[model samples]
Target: MEARMPDPVAGPITEKSDHPRTEGDPQEDGDTPRRVVLADPRSYCAGVERAIEIVERLLRDRPGPIYVRKQIVHNSHVVADLESRGAEFVDELDEVPTGSTVVFSAHGVSPAVRAAAEQRRLEVVDATCPLVTKVHAEARRFTARGDTVVLIGHADHEEVEGTLGEAPETTVLVETPQDVARLEVADPEKVSYLTQTTLAVDETREVIEALRARFPALRGPGSEDICYATTNRQDAVAAVAQEADVVLVVGSANSSNSVRLTELAQRLGTPAHLVDSARDIDPDWVVGARTVAVTAGASAPPWLVEEVIDALADLGPAIVSEHSVATEDVLFALPREVREV
Candidate 1:
């Protein structure tokens, strides 16, 4: 199913002016007034940016419709924009005609998928984020060394599915600490672990700890598999959540990092909700909440964040300011097929 996206250029919704409140209004609750603190480093990260660009570049240079398998990134606004610009998103290789070009989403694909593309003689552009590609390679390496690759990630996510396919027979998907407890492996002494890049930092840490307790000789990657963008966004939200009464994470439900942002805020004891856009906000959520923190998933665009702020400001004379700092220089290059075309 497709996600709903508002007009990208529209202004905030306003039904009526902010009217004077009655005695039972929030002002009588002895809570703080309305304000918004935006989390910096909140929107489009390097990997997501590169993936979108790959499709945009292809659409500009190629003829007819450029087929992309799955949403290039999880944000509906992004997919909608690309679709308007002549990109068609499909579910699988069979949906794409033989000899037609197909671009893999940032969420990688399996060897079998590659073979299918080869058989179809379809021109392929690999837009799989380098970070995700690293995890898949680690899985293969662990399997080659005769170790059971214990993957810590969501079982149903596209990225996890691709990583598991790399070493399906040897890799066991562990979604929770409980999963680790119930895990069965061929050899206890020979085991390794990798993680989905978009998992909650605290969640993954607990899972890893559980894994280590079970497998004393468990080998981890030289670097953590959780992508830098995911960690940074979660860190920003955690810091902001402490000072806010409510938090709003703007992203599609399928966006893993987006869901993690909301969970992190809730874990910090703040009321948080994941939303597709500012239109999804509930007025009751902000009642008696002095301050609200705003953040977007890495795949989300800045425009959606602004819309939330606009809606909040319309709710009252809300004061808005940024509460975090981010210096991001990381970037991934576009796939070669699009570049050479």
Candidate 2:
């Protein structure tokens, strides 16, 4: 079956549950009524909340030309809004004026980037998610104990770079079980592993098993490296994807967690698409799909989810239903600068 395409226009931001319906009551349609199920634990994870708060606070309290090292989060809407509010985003410290205020993206940064920022005397505000910070701490602990640390994550991701910096000489990046098999460690007894917070749970497990099979002494983190948010969102998608004819994941192409959601849905044998808004949706794919499931990534704004729902409602009457695989109430505290004040 062909996949549904996302709408091409940018959609409005709103809470996931606040989707607006068409003019009349949805039940009035004479055709066979199809149901639209929304994933309950779909949007805004705690880490994303903290990151956004950091940017919002910086904008409110600090002066113009505030520089951010990378996209604060993966969503273009969030980045565009920050840019409009006078935040400047750059790939490196040199792009930022010396001694200017700079906030690191939530994806975190390598030690090299941090050193460069310090050399430039940039006033730094670290907006790295606390969960990602946990991975970094794990890398340090393993290295301090004379262990070779295997980091299971996308090698080029900013978060992976930052975590790798904690113990670069001792760290090895593994994206698949194949990578694990070829890994060269100093000693089987002195190896530990950590993961990027936003990795797919099942995929990570396969890699972890591969490492364990190669080295029985391999150590794992006290808790899983994949954060609660990533796990929960994927679980929610998996729960509903089986019942729906099509699945729509609200997220950007570059969003790690969002891409994982789309992958999970497709793995369940349902057609899935990752879109930023309703404009990205291709009506052709949904033409015959009777039931559709909608979800959003952690960094995705709820508004985009609602816009997709609104667009779908315009095509025909939609009986919205809510489905949740798990309940999440996790909340991360704001940075010291924001909380203390």
Candidate 3:
């Protein structure tokens, strides 16, 4: 199902003023609030919240060690926090004991992984994002129609891997438009395309355009595969990046959407960095920057954003305002496995 979020142009909470502190002046001595623009619709999409809650409920209700396959979400801090509370994250199903409860990650899994879990008799609680599940369903549908499916995303990403597994024999992964030229389909006229939910919108559009050029009869999902959260965050970043000197995206290194935010800001001619936390922020990056824009990925926790602002405040008195692009009120129901508990 699609996220129930409104798509709108970003509106600034307050009018930004010129830098009160000059380059030659000391940042610490500034009397004005240091400009910090926080992007609205940042952090913890509904799918991520659902996944984390499923694990938390299982940990609280069940006494046994709760096993999770891969990260419940992409954030390292989230994984570490859960690990401290007795959630065991594993690389493979073999690491989990037979007949024990195991939660699949939010990225979803291939049919092979599900079959492997079945063989081991692991009690499974799927935490796959509904959006990702939608992509998988599309893959299966296209493949069943005897169409060669072209998946757009990084080959190594967990989300892409799971989606690729949906129709391995019929599916091909393409990261860039250049890969489209080398693609070979059994029936050129009967090809369809799908994208990872977390890819950059502009880049994915380019790739889709290339695919259409190569195969004019290309089929696709009824709606774009990029989730609403990803699109909104990118739009927010683009808005702040234009007015900010430097942009800092709060999320782990492996988070695809977080990295996309940094890249988007850089593409807009603003210096940007992907920081896991405030400590990762290079002091130099913000020393001369008057307006520092901050945003978090879907997997990132909201508290982390506050911490970054606190860290920035340490440098000087900061004026923090949110530039909201959209309001997100979407909520996904807890999986049946953990719903009652």
TM-scores across all candidates? 0.90, 0.91, 0.95
Tell me the tens digit of each residue's lDDT in model 1 across 1-341.
12222212212222223322122234435434466777766899888988998998888887867999999999999999999998999999999998888999999998989999999999898999999999989998999999999999987899998998998899999989999999999999999999999999898999999999999999999988998788778877887888889999999999999999999999899999999999999988887678788899999998998888877766655656665544456767777677787
Model 2 TM-score, all chains together: 0.91
Q: lDDT by residue for model 2 over 169-192, one digit each (tens)?
A: 999999999998788989999999
Regions of candidate 3 where Cα sits further than 4 Å from its true position? 1-3, 15-30
Ranking by lDDT: 3, 1, 2
Model 2, position 83: C-alpha lDDT score? 91
Best by lDDT: 3
- RMSD values for the candidates in order, in angstroms, are 7.5, 7.1, 3.1
Candidate 1 lDDT for residue 8:
23
Better of 1 and 2 by lDDT: 1
> In candidate 3, residue 285 scores what lDDT?
87
- Among residues 3 or more apart in sequence or in different chains, the pairs in candidate 1 whose N, CA or C atoms overlap within 3 Å are none
Regions of model 2 farther than 4 Å from truth: 1-30
